[model samples]
Target: MRSIWNGAISFGLVSIPVKLINATESHSVSFRQIHTEDGGRIRYRKVCELEDREVGQDEIGKAYEDADGSMIPITDEDLARLPVPTARTIEIVAFVPEERVDPLQMGSAYYLAASGAPAAKPYTLLREALGRSNRVAIAKFALRGRERLGMLRVVGDAIAMHGLLWPDEVRAPEVVAPDAGVTVRDQELDLADALMATLGEIDLDDLHDEYREALEEVVAAKAAGETPPQAPEAAPPGKVLDLMAALENSVRVARESRGGETSGPAEEAEVRTLPRRGASSRWTPKETGGKKSTSTTAKKTTAKKTTAKKTAAKEADGRKATEKKPVAKKPTAKKRAAKSAQPAERSAARSTAEKATGAGKSTGERSTGAGKSTARKTASRKRSA
Candidate 1:
C-alpha cells in the first residue's frame, strides 16, 4: 500500500515529521497497450519535439512559459530552493462542515496513514478530534511540486484526504431551462415516493459495475474458446402503473407463494430415495419438480453414471478372471517328445494285432473251399452210377 501524502498531523506547536505523498492510488485503474497478434507490450519513449530526437530522462528539466512565449527553464536546484513549506505537515487552516464542500470540488480521494514509523498518540488525537467535531480539516499541501487545496475527512475510524478543484475550475451544468407550462401534481409525487419505498435497502453489494463484469465475462468466455451465454433482456416499465395497487399485489403474491409448502424437487428427491420404491434406479431432484433444476442434476447424474460404468467394467473383468480359465498346451521339448512316442507305440501295437487276425482268417477260407470241392465231386460220381 502506497501513502498518498506522508505529513504529520500537527496541532498548535507540536509537529510530527513525515514524507510528503504518493503519486498513484489503488483505486486508479491502469491499462497496457498490447500488440494484438503476439500480445507484446507497447512502450513509449521521451522525445524532444524541437530537436526531433529521443531524449534520456536525466536530460529532461521542468520549465515555465513567460508572457513573451519564451521558456524559462527551471533546474533541480531551483526546485530544491523553492519554499515547499507544507511538505512535512498537514497545516489545518480551518475546520468546516463536510457537507459545505461540494463533491465536484473533490477530485482524487486517498487513504491517509502516518508514514516513516507510526507516531500513535498524535494520530489518535487528530482522528478523535475530527470525529467529535463532525467536521473535516481543510488544508493546503504541496504535491508534485504544485500547491493543492484539499480536505482531510474522517471515514469510519481512518482519515482520507481528497484533492479539491478551485470554485472557478468547476464547469456549470448544461441542462436547458424548464418550461413554464409544465407542473408536477402532488398525486404523482406521492406515487413516486411509494415506488421508491418498494425498492427495499440500498445495498451497494447488490448493485455493481455490471457492464464491466459482463465485458470481462465475455473476454473470459472467448479466451476459453466458448461462446458466452447471452444476457437476459431487461423488462420495460408499464406505461401506466398503479403504484399502490402493484405493491399490494406483489405483497399478496409473495405471501401466497410462501404459505403452502409445495411438493418441490427437494421433496421429490427424498421420495425417490425411499426403500419402498419399486425402482432400484436413483432419482434426481429435478425429475419430479415442475421447475427445472434439471441442468444441474443431469450433470451430476451423468458424472455418477460414468463412474459406475467404469466400476462395473472392472468388476466384470475381475469375475471373468476368477471363473475357469482355459489351460494352454505346453510347447516345451519334454512334453512334445512324450506325445510323439505315445502315438508311435499305439501305431505299432495295432499293426501287430492286424497281422495275427489276417493269418487265422486265411486258413479258414482254404478249408471251406476244399469242403465245397469234395461235395461237388461226390455228387458227379453218383449221377454217373
Candidate 2:
C-alpha cells in the first residue's frame, strides 16, 4: 500500500513521523446514471431554490445562519486563515481499551507506517507498545480541511488507523425499532438450532458472489459472439401462512440448492464467423493479374493493328491515283489582291495570256488536250492487238 498522507503522530514531546495508507478497499462494481435507450450519461444541474434559477459554481458560497436568521458567508480564504495545529500532525488524545471503540464508529481504515529511516524506530516503538498494552491510541488530525477523529491500533505486523464517525453522525436505534412484544417458543428455538447445525458448512473464502459471477458470464458470452441462455422465470413467492412452515422450507431449500445451485448449459450455441483478417488476406484488384488473359489481349491488339495498316495502304494508293489525274489550281490571294489594287495590271496580264494562247478551251477540253488523250488510247489499242 502506498502512503497517501505524510504526517506525524504527536504524543507528549515525541513526534513519530509516519505515513498513512488506506488498509481497506471496496471491490463492488460501480455504475453511473445513464439514459436507458441511448446510453447517454444523465446530468444534474445545481439551481437556487429561492431564486428559481440555475446556479453557477463560482456564484455559490458557504453560509451559516445564527439565531437572528441572518446569513453569514464563509469564504474559502477565511477557512484557510484559521489556525489548525493538527493539520499535518495526528495529536494523540488518549489511550483506551480496544473494546471501547465500537465498530459502528469506524468509517475508513488505513495502514500507518514509518515515513523514513529516522522515524522507523519511533514507529516500531508505538506499534510494539500498543500491541503489548492491548489498547488503541485515539488521535485527532485535520485532513482535506476537515478534522477527523481516528484511533491507532496494531494490525498483524504493522500499525493501522481507522477514521471514526462522530456520535451524532450515526442514526439512533430508537428512531425505528422492531416489535417489542414478539416472543419465541422453546420448541421453535430448538428447531432453529437443529436447522442451523444441520446446514452444510462453507468456508467464507470459498463462497462466491452469484450475481457478480452471472454478470461476468453474460459479458463473456457477448464477447465470444454468442447469446447467453436466459434464466427460467422464478415462481411467485407465496404468503407465509405459517412461520414454522417457512423456516422448515427454507432449511430444505438451503440443503437442496447447496449442491445443485449451478448447472451446465442446456444447449450449445453457434458462434458467428467473422471475415479473415491478416496481412496476406488484404490486397486490391489492381495488384491481381492473369498471364493467359494478358497474352490473349495482346494477340487481339496485334491483329487489329495489322488490319488497320492494310486498310490505310489501300486508301493512300487510291488518293495518289486521283491526284495524278490532274485538276486546275485556284487563283492565289496575291493575284486577287494585285487585280483589285491595279485593274490596269490585271487587264495587261489577261491580254498577254490570251495572245499567247490564241484560242481558249471552251465547252469541252481544248483540241490539244483531246488529241493527246486519243493518241494515247490508240497507242494502247495497237499494242494490245
Candidate 3:
C-alpha cells in the first residue's frame, strides 16, 4: 500500500517515525455522466463566477463560506500559521480499554508502518505493549488540512490507527428506537433467538461485494455487444400478520441453508403441532441424549395410548346403544296392538244383548194371546151346555 501521510508518534519523551497507509479500500462500481444520444462523456470544469470563465486547478484556492453569504479566502500560509500542535505528529493522549471506543465514532482506518530501521524497535515496543495490555491508545493527529481524533491499536505484528469523530460529532440516537407502546412477547423472543442460532457464525473473509460483481458483468456484456444477464425475480414480500410464524419460517430457511443442522438453542428447540387446534404453535425444547427427554417421550406415548383407549370405549358404548334401540321398539309395538283390540270386544257384546231382549219380548206377547183365546173357548162351551 502507498503511504498517504508521514508522521511520528509522540509517546511521552520518545518519538517513533511512521508512515500512514490506508488499511481499507472501496470496491464499488463508479459511473460517469454522459450524453445518452451521442454516448459522449461529460466533464465538469471549475468556473470563476466573478470572471465568468473556466479556471485551472492552480488558479483555484480554498475558501470558507460564512453565515452572511460572504466568502473568506484561506491560503496555505494562513493555515500553516494556525496554532495546531498535531500537524506532523500523532500525539498519544491516553490509553483506554478497546470497549471505551464507541463503534459509531470510528471512521476511516490506516496502518502505521515503521519509517526506518531506528523506528522498528519503538514501533514493536508499542505494538507489544498494546497487545499485552489489551488497550487502544487515544491519539490526535492532523491530516487533510485538519486535526482529527484517532485510536491506535495493535493489528497482528503491526500497529494500526482508526480515525475517530469528535465526541460532539456523534449524534445521540434519541428517536431511532421503535414506539414505546410496542412490546415483544417471550415466545417471539425465543423464536428470534432460535433464528439467530440457526444462522450461526460465518467467516467475514468469505464475503464479497456481490452488487459490484453483478454490475461489472453487465458492463462487460454491454461492451461485448451481448445481452446482459437477467437476475432471477425476487419473491414478493408478504405482510407479517404473525410475528411468530415469520420467525419460525426464518429459522426453517436458515436450517435448510445449513443442511438442516443448526447450532445452539435451535438444535434444542422443537416445533410441534397442537393436536386440539391442529396448528403448529407449540415450541418444545428437547434435550438430546438426556434422560429427561426420554421420560417426556414416554409420557407422550402413554398419553396417546390413554386417548386411544378412551375413544375406543366411547365407540363401543355407542354401538351398544344402537343395538338396544331395536329391542326397545318391539315391546312398544305389542302394547299398541293390545290397546286397539279393547274397543272391538265392547261393541260385539252390546249387539248380542240387544238381540236377546227383542226375542224375549216377542215370546211373552204370544203366550198372553194364547191364554186369552183358551179362556174364551171355555166360556163358550159352558154356555152351550
Q: Report the number of the highest-lDDT candidate.
A: 3
**Which digits, one per residue and each the tens of the lDDT, describe model 1 over residues 31-122?**
69999999999999899989999999889888999999999998767755667667555677889999999998988776666554556666
For model 1, what is the C-alpha lDDT against the true structure?
Answer: 0.62
Off by over 4 Å in 1: 18-43, 66-69, 116-118, 172-181, 228-385
Candidate 2 error regions (>4 Å)? 32-81, 199-202, 223-225, 251-385
> Candidate 3's error at 317, in angstroms?
20
Q: lDDT by residue for model 3 over 1-385, one digit each (tens)?
A: 8999998999998899999999999889899999999989999989889999999988989899999999999998887677876888999999999999999999999999999999999999899999999899999999988999999998889899999999999988877866688889988888898888788889999998899999999999999999999999999997666666677778888898999886645454444333345555355445564436777779999999999999999999798668658544533443343344345433443343334334453474454344344434443544565
Please identify which of the two predictions, 2 or 3, would achieve the higher lDDT against the true structure: 3
In model 3, the worst 10-residue window by lDDT is: 348-357
Candidate closer to the true structure by TM-score (higher is better), 1 or 3: 3
Model 3 regions lying over 4 Å from their true place: 67-70, 264-385
State the lDDT of candidate 2 residue by residue for 1-385, as single tens digits: 7888888999788888988887877665666899999989998889898998999988999887978998889887866566886878999899999899878899888888888899888888888999999899999987766888999988898988899987778888887888689888774565465456546467899886788777777878988999986889999987666555565555555546665342222111112223346745455322222234676679999999999999999999688547735422212322343354346645654453344335443622463354344334443544565
Q: With candidate 1 superimposed using the best TM-score fit, by how many Å does residue 206's alpha carbon deviate from the native?
A: 3.9
Model 3 CA lDDT for position 21: 97
Q: For candidate 3, what is the total of clashing residue pairs?
A: 0
